[model samples]
Target chain A: MNSHLILRTVSKFLIPLIVVYGLYVHFHGDFGPGGGFQAGVIVAAAVVLYALIFGLDACKVAVPPSWIRIGMTTGVLLYVGTGVVTWLLGGAFLDYDVLRNNPDHPAGQHLGIILVELGVLFTVATVMVAIFYAFGSRTPDISDEDW
Target chain B: MLNLINAAAAQAGNVPPTLIIDICLMAMLVVVAFAIVRIRSLFAIVMLQGVYSLLSAAWFVSLDAVDVAFTESAVGAGISTVLMLSAMLLTDRKSAPVPVKKALGPLMVCVLAGAAMFYAIPDMPAFGDPDSPANTGPGMEYMTASVKQVEVPNVVTAVLASYRGYDTMAETVVIFMAGLGVLLLLGLNGNAGFWQAKVQGQNICTQAAPRARILTSPSDKPNTEPRAPGDPEPSSKNTSVKKVAAKKTAARKTAAKKPATKRTTSKKAAKKPAKPKGEAS
Candidate 1:
């Protein structure tokens, strides 16, 4: 059917746009309706879209399990590490005030928020993909006729 | 229409036009939810669930919880549907209808719980009540402080990332654990021999017909390998390079009885297994 061809062509076109939009949402959270959580899911949806079109095997080839694991770990570490850094800087745990030099400017809060959100982006994106992989991989070999 | 005028008036904050949009969305949601309950096909149910999620996401946006709306659509409608479809492949497509007797207890519980919630609704603050405790409490402090101290234009991000950092971190940990649980239940390889998977495996998930992929796309197969020609095709044109255990072996057992020839019928027996080797190894 032309539907298959359309899906393939459309997905190829849409994947990059989705990923970029996800990044936009990630960075633009401060001024608009977004955050790391939403951004991460959007980015993962791109990968999921890729998987749906190209097949899960090809999808996994593009993003391996090991890389997914690293992403999840890095996201959590980056988040807590910022907290630990703040603690080391002599503020209460997760206090963003110590992140900047000048007390007058909200620079510390700004930096801390960005870093923490980045961490959330990392974890949320990888976890969603990882969950997808787990489910996708475990599937039995069902053909199109099964429907 | 008068309704359009009412909607516009509501937007100007004088008339609270919650009923128009909210009623339409809620009615659709209820219908979809009921349809999902009655549907015998798991596939249809999954699709309906996505519809429900989208409806709810739109409702969330109407309620001014744009952030929540964003998540509900993506995670709930987008990813969850895909995940459910994949998971469904492993099970029977049609769900067995539940016995009325067996369903009664849960149905009663649901009705009672819904009744209790409805009764409690009167005590709850009206939507967007500025005098409400939630709006006036430390939540107000977070909002005001975010502008002056955090300087972030969107207070939601400021609250989630800064003021409620620990809560967000805990939520992240919870997500991480959910991933962990799925990984434990289903190996990323989805193969029986988890250890057998090579360091540079071509595919992790055997989603579609495994061997069919290699046949359809020649460039994807490593031409250097002499075994490409001998790789057991699914006979019926299924795909996957990973050795799916059940069907292939049964097919090979029959093929093993037939003499090994390089024809389509002689798929399984050509190699070592008397039957065709399901994998390249």
Candidate 2:
């Protein structure tokens, strides 16, 4: 499988671009047809493509399953933490209105939306990669030729 | 080019110009569905299912639900295909054929469902109807409020991340829990202790790198991961990232297993060689 020079070379070229596009989709969501979930999926797809070309062990080394566990927790925390912060800031739960207080500015809402979306991005992406690892790491009872 | 423009103008009387595309996508979707039902090969079925999703995503785009289209393509067409393929690797390639009588009941159910859909459609608003119930009521309110409060250009993002932030957070939590559940059921490996080993290794490396450094040669990167487990013998614990390292660990483990297999064989051979015949009750 390592003999697949074409796939290896092509993926090496494409993965960075894919990741950049995912970030673009994330940041541009406020003005376009994309969001955190889509961005996360796109980024995870890059990692998955790398895993497919390389092997599961190599990917585990690169992304490290331990980090994935941490990422899953971190993303959830970041999301919920925003709401808790909003609550602590004297607005209702997830009320982005209190995130910042320039009396005439929409800055609070903008900041809140970005933080929460970032959180969504993290959880969705890491969960996707974790699930991929679970499936890919299996020593399949069936083989490629059989399938 | 003129004929194309004329065609667009002709169809622009009331229907959208993309109506042909909608029809074509729908027809392909039906064909793919039937192919999925008829195909015995699970691999082909999985591929067709992905194609089905892609077609539907295109249909969503045509219907102006671009946000939904984005999600459908990413989740359904992209990741679902990969996950399904990986999962299908665990099972046989072909699906068992259902008996005609068994399928007949499902066919009746499908017929009834399709009939109900058609029956309901007449009472529903036409596609993209501006005055539809969904377009009015709370929808208008959200649209207006989103502009005034969030100042976000995309109302979908505003609604999802602002107005319905709680629901989205819950969904994120749900995904997190799903990951945890999968890890628990699968054990990150088919074994019980690998995840524990990896986590312990990380803490060791981070907390005491200098002390841990004394135990390994520069080349023993695999040793780093397996050292912290302390469960397997030191020799068999070279679970490195490289393929060579993996093979070395596997060979070591197998060597350790050789005598265990021999003992099992000896135990089986020592069992009584008595044969008994049973009569049907």
Candidate 3:
């Protein structure tokens, strides 16, 4: 098989698996060692690999810059929104127990963990992609004029 | 005394496997650092810099700082490498090889500082002592309590956003300033008319929107006349004729409006006779 086709086929299956593993690591952090940051990087790494094997242009077609910007903003908003919700419910910022009427329930911890992990994933993935664009993209003016 | 020194050497050689591996990695790091400095080729030096980041990530992993290791691998190995590559493309890829310079004053200062740090480490907590005063500090208490009370599983986020939120805000402001600086350097704000003139001339986006019809006729009318290279083509003449026809149509519409308005006033006067007779009846 050609390299591009092979990469396409592999990424089709690989990205979802990486995302699932990232979510597992994110949720399992309280019991195990891995957490939001690690999960975020893992998922971002998988996407970066996809970008590397395929051309940057093709990679961009798959996930455009606008979508990445939105994802990053959504992640930060989710984290902030959770805090605001807790604050509104008569608790300090990020106080998880205030998410529900029942303070003793473990559901708040679950909800808080999921939201923070999603935010971490969003920020890490977008920043990775943005930095990639910064260094990889060359203006035609700069590129055409050989230094 | 000779026997005692030999025995000590033998015991050192029998150090645990993990310690041996750590020593090996440290030695490799030293070799990489020396190579980075001594290498004459700029291209090779840039590649070695990326290698250095990967090695550092490995060290973090060995130290059980997985989060830090992941960040280093992604940012250092990935992002920094891309940045260095871009910089390399912008300039000449060769370095002038010079003999090693004399390192007298700064080298001595660095060595002395390193020695002082080594001396200070002995008074700090032993490798992994859980009950050490350093480990039992209020920071540790905060970390433990924050996990249960703050509700976020990621203590880093809690500490960064809630406990030390002001610092995060300041960092964000710095990032915003940097973005603004980049925009200023790129001249995005200068000569607002530059984009306006280009847009008005081309009308590319105007065609996409319904409201942009205001920009269509006048601008496109003159510009599209020269599209045909040869007048021998029948379609070219027909299109030019169509343009003339459109201008005639516009003139006729303007001409027709005044007469239509006058006709309406005359029609109203004619209708007054019918209205008066109906009122009399």
TM-score, chain A, candidate 2: 0.91
Query: Predictions ranked by DockQ, top down?
Result: 1, 2, 3
**lDDT (Cα, tens digit) per residue for candidate 1, span A1-147:** 124898899899999999999999999998899999999999999999988887665676687778888998899999999999999999989998898878688789888988898889999999899887766654423334345
Residue B167 displacement (Å), model 2: 0.6
Worst 10 residues of 1 chain B by lDDT: B268-277
Candidate 2 regions exceeding 4 Å error are A140-147, B1-15, B102-108, B192-281
Better model by TM-score, 1 or 2? Answer: 2
Which candidate, 1 or 2, has the higher DockQ? 1
**Residues A71-142 of candidate 2: C-alpha lDDT, one tens digit per residue:** 888888988999999999999999988888877778898888888888888888888988887776554222
Error of 2 at A104 (Å): 1.5
CAPRI docking class of candidate 3: incorrect
Q: Could you give me the TM-score of model 2 versus the true structure?
A: 0.76
Q: After superposition, how far is residue A115 of candidate 3 from its true place, in Å?
A: 1.3
Worst 10 residues of 2 chain B by lDDT: B207-216
Give per-residue lDDT, candidate 3, residue B168.
44
Off by over 4 Å in 3: A1-24, A139-147, B1-14, B98-100, B142-281
Q: Write the per-residue lDDT of candidate 1 for residues B195-247, one digit (tens) a residue.
A: 22345865553334333111223222322224566687444323433333444
lDDT of each: 0.76, 0.74, 0.57
In model 1, the clashing pairs are: B209-B239, B209-B240, B210-B239, B210-B240, B211-B239, B211-B240, B212-B239, B268-B275, B268-B276, B269-B276
